[model samples]
Target: MLNTQHYPQMISPSLMGEWIVIASEQEFVQRQQIKTCLDGQTLTLHRDTINGVHVYQVNFESLDMKELNLSVQAAYGFVWLCIGSEKKPLFQLQEYDVEGARRVPCGAYGVRTSPLRGIENFLDMAHFPYVHTGILGAEPETTVKPYKVEWREDVDEIWATECFFTQPLAAPSSPQPQETEYVYRVASPLNAILYKVNTAAEGIIPADVVCLFIQPLSETHIRAHLLMILDDQTSSMTDMVLFQQKIFTQDKPILENHVPLKLPLEKLEIPTKADALATAYRKWLITKNWCYGVHKNTQEEQVV
Candidate 1:
């Protein structure tokens, strides 16, 4: 179990069933002991291999030096830590189980922004043309088409589909520009998955998945853990990782500077049809009664 007193906003029951990224497998292997501060408390993570299976042991300072018997492991080169009970189902979906998809691990990048803000920015496609420029989007193709957004009753997840965008370099192996179709899923408040059409090759691939898992250290700090499950038969893993890093590098400044750090659940001043997914996400957070990382103008309206 996680120390909820140290991470009340992140350890809420609403997010108990979700998995959080603590460190990369490489980071743990290289450092041996990884130290992180969460909610003003220090957590030291140590790596161990049991019967040739990699695992991690975590020690919390606030818990009176008690060692958590958690066995952290790497899935697709990411070090994952769970906060919930063993009986609860994980937030993973079948889409993430791509057999031949190359895993490109984008190391945990720190940002002085709310975790919700990082996710909301990832869900925003309109910024590609301006922020990502020629890589993801470009000028004259800036219009965002209307997409469908709804809560899936069967899975209890929010989805947005029918999203199409023209991109110059949608993937590292692409030779020319293509029209990319996308489907976005908010698996949880701190997790999001994107399924995109890979059209750079003959017989375009139906879907290439990218998962974003965010760790909220505080109300105003977060670390983005990105994993890309791609279908590219070309391009080396190093090339793919560099390409993805450049895109996020461009997004970092914009994300870090977002006003009012915490997300606002109220109506926006200039809400557009393109913001449908973000709107739905905000509604979902409100429904879950998750307000620790949210902001309200009046003290009486705050949830903390």
Candidate 2:
């Protein structure tokens, strides 16, 4: 077993039946067994040549492993596990099938914070000039212009479009600074992706898709699995990986320092225009009655 028994705040019922990223597909392919926890119970993922992948949860009574009935799935180079009787289909990523695009599954990066907070941090554009300075954004152009935020009924996704920001280095292959357009999509409370299209002088290009599939170890612990499908052919694989690692490492400390730890469902802090997407994200959670990893200001939490 990779970890021991979990005794965290119980994951809410509303968050069930949803697909959660468990581990990188390659990780399991390399190491057959990956043991972890979910919903306050310990889980072991075993991949075999004959039986395929089997998930076993710790039997509380006997402290023995009992195989779960549900099956594990592989999508976009990552393994996923669903926790309830009813499982929703994983979100679609058309960018993954695009020809000539580079697929980079950078593996899991741990963060000691709420999964909601992790996703919210990825959706914010205002922090770029400060948090990821000189690479994602720069000074004097930090204004987050008015963007369109909508809840697509058909897809059940929160979409934020018409978002633009000036970046000193938008991608590993970028030669100069440019104005970048972004379309941020929140597939679920813990899963989000942003399509980045940098301004070009000659031809139109497909946006590079960057996805954050969060694995909630508990209410406060998370494994941020970053997957990217890019149109760049010039940059080396090492450069692309380093660029992403650099960006996320910069945001790690800030995410961990959040006072509440879990996202507050109430109006605890005042948000400005730049937080339009984040504001809409919270409202969407309220509509679904999602209670996982969320707290209210009236109810205080003990900070450890």
Residue 227 of model 1 has an lDDT of 82
lDDT of 2 by residue, 131-186 (tens): 98899888888888899999997888999999988899998888899889899999
| Model 2 global lDDT (CA atoms, 0 to 1) | 0.79
**Best-fitting candidate, scored by TM-score:** 2
TM-score of 2: 0.88
Q: Return the number of clashes found in candidate 2.
A: 0
Q: 1-304, model 1: which lDDT tens digit per residue?
A: 5555664433444444456667778686567788885544468888887898887877766655332234355665666665445323346655445566666777778888878999999999999999999988999999999999999867678999999999998988878998899999987778799998887533333577788888777767888888887888788889988988898889899987777777888764357888989989999888878765676767533211
Residue range with the least summed lDDT across 10 consecutive positions in model 1: 63-72
Off by more than 4 A, model 2:
1-11, 50-69, 199-205, 302-304
Each prediction's RMSD to truth: 3.7, 4.8
* TM-score for each candidate, following the candidate numbering: 0.86, 0.88
